[model samples]
Target chain A: MAPPPLAALHSLGFPAKRLADLATMAGLSLWQPQAGNAGGRVKPTALRVLVLLGHAWEDQVANTWTEPYTAWIEVAALADHSILELIQRARDTSLYISFTTITANRRDLAGEVLSMIGGRRRLSRDSRDNIELALHEALSNAVLHGNLQLESLSGLSVDALERFSNNLTCRITDPDFANRRIDVICDIIGDAVTIDVVDQGNGFLPKPRPEPQASGRGFDLISVSCQSFRLLDGGRRLSMRFPA
Target chain B: MDYAIDIKEQEALVRLTGRLTFNDHAKLRALIKEMLQNAAKRQILDLANLEFVDSAGIGMLLIAREELSNLDKQFILRKAGGQVKRVLTVAQLGKLITIEE
Candidate 1:
């Protein structure tokens, strides 16, 4: 089948130069519904793949376009290589979202990603719960240990917990840590959907905690929840596969 | 996550609603403090309305349990259903804390 037609949309304040670069990289035609039509207007439903440059475009597309589209990409996440992969995978529904550590901390990213994918594919209740749990753990690891470089809570003591909380507050407020990028890439192939949570930080390997403790169950939960998973990029990237 | 606590003479029942994750650390800390100060000997967390929980949320629950145990108060998890219940089971939380149906 021919590749679905792709269009790029941006919100106010998004750089036109970057949009043009993205359009060139992905061979996407620009669609500015908000801008008065100099050329004939194309109906939103006609576009099969939308590359959204800002959060506002997401809301606008959701509200204005009633028909289901093949896939959508958040432009913030467009690395040169990932952009190429996204074009290749656009034939299958996929999503790429990248956000700063502060944004990830503030938003329910796992839930939002799940809801977005749920719109494209039907997920069983059990599968949905499992994916949500695994994705939540993966994102937490990315934002906390991966991006912000916060250590796992040392112990269950109130004092230890207090110190951890203080450090979390400190790191999240620091722009150096707060502005680190976290990328989530999702691709659907056949009956399985693979989601990768990638972070820019010093990578980490999970340590075994033989004793019952307050922390360190993130990996355990992820292992049990997903069909299979792997830690790549020196543990900076976690890829999880789930049944759709 | 948000909670409503009812401190009775024998037990303090805290109903936790909404999703619990690492983001709720501050709120969880405050809840732990409240549970520690309550006069009741048993602290129960009602998880029926808790729609979801992550591993970090599980750790926070462990913190609550440990803090209460240190104070010679019993910590119990009650009415965990759906995702919460499944997570509690997968984490083997029942072995560490008392869980009531």
Candidate 2:
């Protein structure tokens, strides 16, 4: 008998409505499993492809189904691409995500990306933690320091923090700063995974601090967490690599 | 992040849960105010349930420690496990704050 024309599109942690819309746009009939069905369990016999978006459903999908081609893609990466193209790219390429500074500030971009990647590949606990930390620093720098052009927290005082907060609020509320784009591109080849975080900023020059302070340890943490990293495009782009 | 604080005669123990990132600035600010106004001389932050933290979170913690120290008060972090523990070690935060395992 011919395989069922239905496709199983699991939202994982991604929004169900978005996934459903994507499925509709792709001209595919979707078979959504009942909500709160333990593990999002679905029989794969009638499915052509399994498209799992987001990372929240990783363990469930892993333990539930093994057959059928699965495309693990981040929902944010869905923009500007046809669903068919995305599924093909999910198999051939990796992930490319672009969002405005406002979205980056509002979402846990690093965590979502890490979870998507982790679902597709097996990352050791330590490696996952390191990647998550390094990515968090990279995204934070791209949003706050690069795109928003905000100064570092100068001192360890409530007043200083308040000033910083005020500055952040002011900048984020401004369209010129908030609307700048930040792009994250990920690629996996052999045993290495490379992620590049690019921002639309004027670029930065790293300076060495002479004293131990409360802030400015972002680069330090990123340096130790990833295997290797490079600041390109005049510091507007941070490229980091990790062991797959 | 969310926190529940227990105030005693000499110390205030705060149990912090959820992810403590830069986004928690407002809450952290409120937490700092509570720590400063309370009569307790020692502020203990329990991180046993805090699942994750970032560089900004670390900076906020430093801010708390510094503000408390200005008034001769002590700040301590205890029971940080998993990812939080690893981040603290990597950031070399132990040299600056008292972390109780």
Candidate 3:
């Protein structure tokens, strides 16, 4: 059979339930192929990517998230292999956020994300090491403290566990500054850009008066070098503002 | 907790593996000071085998050096290649810390 025309595929339509709200909260765009290739070709709008994904390819589809203008995708093609792989590959074209959320011992994920964000990703060798270290710490807390309380995602079980995954949750509080949930705001004024991170977690633990052990200090790298940092946890905020 | 620490009591050679992020700062700082106290007035620490060092690591290094300098001690740095060295350079420590070979 001849390949379906690219224009034949129409945007997905839905019953307009809480999907829209969820999308907004999660920061993502949902697209699904509608009907079969022939049905989509004829009526065009009869089937949409998100709906088709929901009905026909639920197993092939993974959770999606969005941040501001970008929707992050977690695409997995291992199960369907040949048929669905080609379909998903042809479905979209842009920056893929698949690997960003995956936490592994390898340090490539952070580097990939920094490069994707198109910011000043070039850190000194030491800073690069520090950034990865911080990332690991954050990921560890997210997985251990946050997700550890939740049930496992499907096929992602250990021991006698069996379940499909749902939304990921994070604790609102953690002692580490780098592990805090923060919104980094970048304001560019003329030739300079001011980068600020608004965190929901507590600021640095109070400095030790009796000269504490070096191994137990937290976020020492960022604390020392980041132009300025202020904690307003009493006011429910921890802000780090620096010249970017 | 997959980490290792090696300290040379005299020359300030501290080798660390695994992570040295903010969460581990308390431990890192204490280790650094401990090494400094047992070292010569001048020291060169090697971080070549360190797997990672986060913002906390950076802070400790800077603050520790300041304290050491105040005590008339010079803590030189040595051999951190790849990502770690790049991070050090970006953090402006490449100029402040002596990067030996």
lDDT of each: 0.77, 0.77, 0.39
User: What does fnat come to for each candidate?
Assistant: 0.80, 0.72, 0.11
- On a 0 to 100 scale, what is the lDDT of residue A96 in model 3? 25
lDDT of 3 by residue, A1-244 (tens): 2212222111122234434543443333544433443221433222223221222123222221111112122222212333233234333322222211122212333344333233323345444344334433333323322323233122211111111111222321222322322222333233332333222322333344343322222334345444455545442333333332
Q: Chain B TM-score of all predictions, in order?
A: 0.98, 0.99, 0.79
The regions of model 2 sitting more than 4 angstroms off are: A1-93
lDDT of residue B35 for candidate 2: 95
Off by over 4 Å in 1: A1-6, A15-26, A33-93
Best candidate (score: DockQ): 1
By TM-score: ranked, best first: 1, 2, 3
Separate clash counts for every candidate? 0, 0, 54
Q: What lDDT tens digits, residue by residue, belong to model 2 across residues B10-53?
A: 98999999999989999999999999999999999999999999
lDDT (C-alpha) at residue A144 in model 2: 91
DockQ by candidate, in order: 0.82, 0.65, 0.09
Error of 2 at A101 (Å): 0.7
Q: Score residue A177 of candidate 3 by CA lDDT.
A: 22
lDDT of 2 by residue, A1-27 (tens): 222433545555667677677777666
Q: What is the C-alpha RMSD of each candidate to the true structure, in Å?
A: 4.5, 6.7, 14.3
Across A48-110, the per-residue lDDT of candidate 1 in tens digits comes to 545443432333434422223334444454466775565555543456665678777776778
Residue B59 accuracy (lDDT) in model 3: 52
Stretches of candidate 3 off by over 4 Å are: A1-244, B1-9, B52-56
